[model samples]
Target: MSVQEHRRLRELASMHFQSRCLHEACERGLFSELERSPGSAEELARRLHLHPQACRMLLDALTALALLQEREGLYSNAPIASRYLIEGTATDQGEMIAMYRRSMERWEKLAEALHCGHTPAPPSEPDPRFIHAMHCTASVHAPLVVEAVPRNNARRLLDLGGGPGTYSIRFLLTWPEAEARMLDLEPVVSIAQEYAEIAGVNERFEAVAGDYLESELGDGYDLVLLSNILHCNAPEGCQRLLKRAFACLRPGGRVVIHEFLRDGSLWPAVFALHMLLSTPGGDTYSESTLKGWLHEAGFGEPVVSRLEGTPSSVLVAARS
Candidate 1:
């Protein structure tokens, strides 16, 4: 390899070292402790019950990564960390990091999965942290999607696979007359209930606990949202879901599919790899493929648009 190529390859190969440091810090509540108050290495170690030497090393590494700031032997959360990494904040991503940590073990077996043609066995019960992580992610991007949706006299919505019902709550808040039914797994639906109650939309929001792939979806909905759901299945599964959504919506009602499009974006490519590692046949889809699926599912020509301020794009089609 050329000199520059060798250097680039080395940096890429060692990227996991940096990720491990960040994930470990988040797992250990380092950011939360710093958010409460700045402290020296020994002080933080004592508070979080870590060995002094290891804690000091982690603190220094976090500082180097710009997630923390250090001054005069004291460490504190950086502005970004304070806003998004500290637990209990409005935009806290602690749960998301925790979910990543939980997935790390499965991700480490990617090579084995490729050889065996399947992922490892799933846990018996759903992990609550994963649901919270989806909530955190949806809370940040739901508003962007809501703006893109057209809600003219739309009174009912079906949030298919709505993990935490963040989008449904936002939709309800945007259109006061609208009511929503969130369909998801039982464990995830329970979390959605809490979120709806907290948003004060429980009176208008209902949770349906079942698999979207196998459950019966009620009819006569003005809007059906398939946000972030398609990438969880293969193409045939996506077609089945689109057909189901088509069957459930009222005539002239719109079905919105929110997903990361394969349009040469770096993030989508990286997320596709993540799906490969974690799911049986999930991967990001192209816009042409989604449009074709919608057409096959009995929807009219779909309009594809990118959501502002988010990585996702939307395809809105109306049932004839």
Candidate 2:
């Protein structure tokens, strides 16, 4: 390979160094602290109980990463980090960073998992951290997705596998006349209710604690939303889930699917390997494959749209 290609490969290999630095910053609450109180490295180190020199080094690294800005020996969160890294902000993603940190161990076991066939069996109740991470990720994107969805006079909708119900809650915000029903595991649904209550949409939201695949989803709904749900299952299971979603919709009702579709992006291709490491049959699917599944499930021609600035895509199809 040419020297330029070699340099790029080296950068790719060591890119985890950057991620680890950001993860460490999240662990230490540095970004949030900087947002609330921008100060010199010495002051921050004293406040956060870090070694002075080490804190300065970290601060400089984060500044280099553009997540923080250093001005005249004082440091503060850059606009990007200020918006998404500060705790309790509407777009906070600290929990998501922690969740990714926790998943490192699982990713480390990829070789063994590949040798064997699957990762360890999932816990009966998912880690609460995972739910919180999903909430953070979803909350950041909910507005974009909720806007892209064609309301189609959807007075009622089903959020299948709606972890934390972030999208559903946001939908209620815009579609004031609409109500949302979310179905998931008991623990996840309980957490979803908490978020719904926090968003003040619980009155119009119903959280059902059950497996959506096997549960009885009442019919005649105006919409069904499957966000980040399809990629968790094998082909047969995905097809089955789509048919179940189909039956739960009324004639002319809409089904909206949101996922990290493989659309010639580096992220989705890598995410496919993540699925291989983490799931039995999950992978980043392509648009054609997804369209075929929707067609097989008896839906009319589907319209697909890519969410700007993200790998995730949304597909909307109608039941005739």
TM-score (C-alpha, index-matched) for candidate 2: 0.94
Candidate 1, residues 1-320, lDDT tens digits: the string is 89999999998999878888989988888898888899999999999999999999999989999999999999999999989988787788988877877777877877887797767656646678888999888998888888888887999999998988999999999999999999988788888999999999999999988888889998999999999999988898899999999999999999999999998988788788788777768899999999889989999998888987678998889999
Off by over 4 Å in 2: 1-3
TM-score of each: 0.94, 0.94
Q: In candidate 2, what are the lDDT values of residues 1-320, reduced to their tens digit? A: 99999999999999888999999999988988997889999999998999999999999999999999999999998999988888777778889999888878878888887798778765667777898999988987888898788887899999999999999999999999999999998878889999999999999999998887799999999999999988888788889989999999999998999999887889888888777776778788899999999999999999888899888999999998
Write down the lDDT of every candidate, Cα atoms only: 0.89, 0.90
> Candidate 1, 5: how far from true, in Å?
3.4
Q: How much is 233 displaced in model 2, in angstroms?
A: 1.2
